[model samples]
Target: MKKLNFTSITKYTILFLIALLLTVTAIVFLEGRKSKNISLWITPASYFNEGWYYFDSDSRRQEIDSLPVRIPADKFGTARIYHKMVRSSHYCMYIDYYAHHQAVKAFFNDELIFEYAPPSNPGWLKSYRSFHNLIAIPLNRDGILCIETKASISSTAGEFGQIRIGSRDELLNRIVSERLPQFLLGAVLIVLGFILFIITAFYLRVAFDRTILYFTLLLIFLGVWQTEESRLLQFFIGFQALHWFFEYMMQPFILILSFLFIKELFINKKHPALIILFACITLSIFTQLILQITGIAQMTSTLFMINSMFIVVFAYILVLINLNFEFARKSVKVIFSISIALCIVSFIISSAVKHHKNFTDPILYLGIVFLFISISIFVIQKTQKQFNAVRSAEIYKKLAFLDISTGVSNQTAWYTLIENFSADGIKLDKYCMFMFDMNNLKTINDQYGHLEGDKAIRSFCECLKRAVGKSGDIYRIGGDEFICLCKNIDYTRATQIENMFDYYVKNQTESKVQFTAAHGYAFFSPSSKADFIQAQSMADKAMYENKILSKKGRS
Candidate 1:
């Protein structure tokens, strides 16, 4: 790895430059748009941000047409509409606007003109009117037109947004132009989420990355949240109040997944506080869910505050982890530092805004994008480490079973194989065990040093391997001692192979010193439960007896 300080500085510089470029570009984009006055017709909705008869709570609205504009888009509650008679000599007045998770009532000069169904009404939920619905409020009022609206969630700043009071055709055009940006970006995010989901599902191996999986889930929820909040889902699918479910549920989803992501990222750290915080968040979500489902409580006010606290708490944890250095790498520290700072700034800006109609702060979304990139880098690095560790373990395991001198199975492998066969509750059939002992290994070692003796042993083992080939398994038990377990081989073939081994020992010039091995074989017919070990013992005793016979013949 590069020096931590230099790598950290370099990464910070690049990230800062990228953020700067994006920020400047955003500023330029915002600067390009000229603010239009309320009286203009180019964008009529831009004129009606405030300045109308508005109330969040239940109260009788008075009919009166006020001035041009009053409230900003970020302030709470419905699109306030008052009487604005068209100067046309023939055309009747009609108002067009967008309604969010809210219902409205309009009064014409203190007379009940119309009462919009509340979002809680099943009829409202079943309406084909999307949140992007350009609701047309027809007015036959000569005196005044009064509108009052409220949202389901008390914590939500505004119930309805993008209010426009004008001719139907002009407001329709404005609707299209204003909603285009939200739809495009929402679609892009949804597609990006789907792609990430596929990558998390398919490319992972035996030992998978949980962090990436969780992060992918986070992306998916983020996309859903953005899409629903953008009112595009309504425009596309005609899902009216259903967006409220997504809007409410997404915070808990993000919170849970983020907790899991952080946990997976810091495997080495044991933070009891993190665990406790996760538990509290989980409990809060479940309790709120139960209450919302049972009609015991509304999810708007309390859960909103809880979600806000979760963000702050999670940010604080990230900062503390990064600062400790014991819990975080330099790259991770840099990422978290940027993340915490961004979170704070975004939170402040969002809170300071008077009318926050957007789904989320754009600054927070930017942080989310960078956090994802950093996490991906960490996952790739962590996965490589896991792969290397697995490879090392396999190499070590192979080394434990190998005989360095003979390149065959060592005694450890021999014992392990027996234990496995026994544990598996299986019996061997048509099996033969051959036991062999070198005739003069001690004499050869004494006369020609240990290296020559080792050479003789290797040559004998190599010659035996050639004769046996794939017909059996061989084990180097001890110095000058060996065993071969030949499966599926009849007695005759085992004898022939054994004789071939003896011939190679006597005539093969590969060994520096002439040598022979006294060998004996035991065969088992059909099958026997204890056959494997019994055959080995019998073969060993027969080999020693044969050794005595060979010494007598030599004498």
Candidate 2:
């Protein structure tokens, strides 16, 4: 792994801050400029089509999916409707409307203004209705609007949702402003989930427990579910059965997934409640699916909320039990607190929306945003700790093996390395060993101080490194003694390496004291009778002889 530098970190930090600033600035701007929603006119049931009719055939009006909001119906034929109202003098500069599943031909004040035909496939709808316009009637006094929509079983289930008008720029701005945080937050959570998933499955592999994996999957489900619940999803899903599934099914699914995630996170022993909770949720989900699919049950947001609350209640009780667990980490406590808080807040908001029709709150999205942000911080901290631990272990291993005085492998490391190779069944014949002895080291230490002697030793080690390069491993075997092991090298090259070190020392000018060493080398082949122990003794004897010869030359 590559090391992170200050430059790179600073660059990334600056970039992230800039992006965050821009996003916040834009959000503030959108929030500051309030876009007041003004309903133009309500669709009233009518029997007349105003002399305009196309695709009046029965085959084109097959039932597919029900709408979220109710509109006046005509079960036998298309529900022909018209509305007469005055546009407010304070009308904003923009207009937005959602005539769910309606094939519309609209007119304002007896003048044909707009036209749109529903597609065969329901997928033509997207998450946002930026361009899906039913009509472009100019806001004026005494405006008369007409819409001919196909009918369904329910009163207003066929033509669903409301037609809203607001400022053009402000409407688009509000659309993004309201939904942006949820979209971005959900996207980020999804990415984090994928990262954790990959880490568990690939990077960490076998080490990590399944708790993290379950958490990752829970996050993914939450993100997708949250996105689906947002107003933005209306444009993406159109008016298909998928909309109901997302609104109803994903809620219970996330709740159940969270149960599993929590169980794995802190509970080593699965409580009976865990199995019962899972079985009940599983049964509810499948039962709901069967009923809805078979048309026996009509799914509604109220019923969905009830199911979600049931799971949430059980989850809270489980969390309360685990929060008191003696072995739980502080992180686990924090997560528990956060989950409970979010659950309480969400339940209140959901209940308020269900009972009180006029109530609206954007603060609900903040819970999701905060939850993921908290999880992201935890992930970063945990991953960083793991990385630091591995790096520290490597550093300690290096420290244990290194000779502190000369930065060469110490005797202990030398034996370990040899043993590892020998244990692997590699014979000494595959290696060439050169032993070195520093001549007159005790005399130098007596003449000068130990510091200068140490300097001389380090200088000799440096010279040896320059001579050997990457050809072999060097070890400070003992006091004033060193050894080099070169694998697959012949005696000739070992002799050349020894001479290079000797030449480098003789030509040295930077050091205050001259450094000299005597070396003797021996090559071992597979057929050789001498073991490594015997070869080391032979090398030491030859090195002492060389030292004696050098002493005579000095005389």
User: After aligning candidate 2 to the native by TM-score, how far in Å is the CA of 536 from where it should be?
Assistant: 10
Give candidates' CA RMSD values in order.
Answer: 11.3, 10.9
What's each prediction's clash count?
9, 12
Residues 1-555 of candidate 1 have per-residue lDDT tens digits of 666698899999999999999999999879867765354345444345444554334555543243333332234544555554334453454455454345666666666655655445642232222243343444443455566555544433243444555666676567656565655555666676677556445553325567657766776776777666555565456444556667777878877887777776454557786677677777788887666666566665445555565566557446554544332256655765675666555655554552453534565455455445544444555556666776788779889998999999889988887766633236435778889888889999999999999999999898889878899989999998888988778877988987888788788787779997888989864343466778888999999998998889889
* lDDT (C-alpha) at residue 72 in model 2: 38
How would you encode candidate 2's per-residue C-alpha lDDT over 1-555 as one tens digit per residue? 989999999999999999999999999889977976564433321222122222223535233232233333545435644554567674322234454434556666667666655444333222111223524446556565655555222323334344444555445555556566777666777787898878766875434645566668778887786676555666566764565556566676776766665565445446776666666667766766565455555344225544464436445544644553332267755675575566457556645575433243344555565455544544445555555676688789999999999899999998786565432345434777789988889988999888988888888888898888899999998888999888888767888898899998998765588977898877664343336667788788888888889889989
lDDT at 215, model 2: 67
**How good is model 1 by TM-score?**
0.57
Question: What TM-score should be assigned to candidate 2?
Answer: 0.58
* lDDT score, candidate 2: 0.62
Q: Which candidate ranks first by TM-score, i.e. highest?
A: 2
Specify the poorest-scoring 10-residue window by lDDT in model 1: 123-132
Candidate 1 Cα errors over 4 Å, as ranges: 1-99, 102-247, 260-283, 294-303, 316-320, 323-336, 339-361, 376-391, 420-439, 464-473, 484-510, 518-532, 539-555
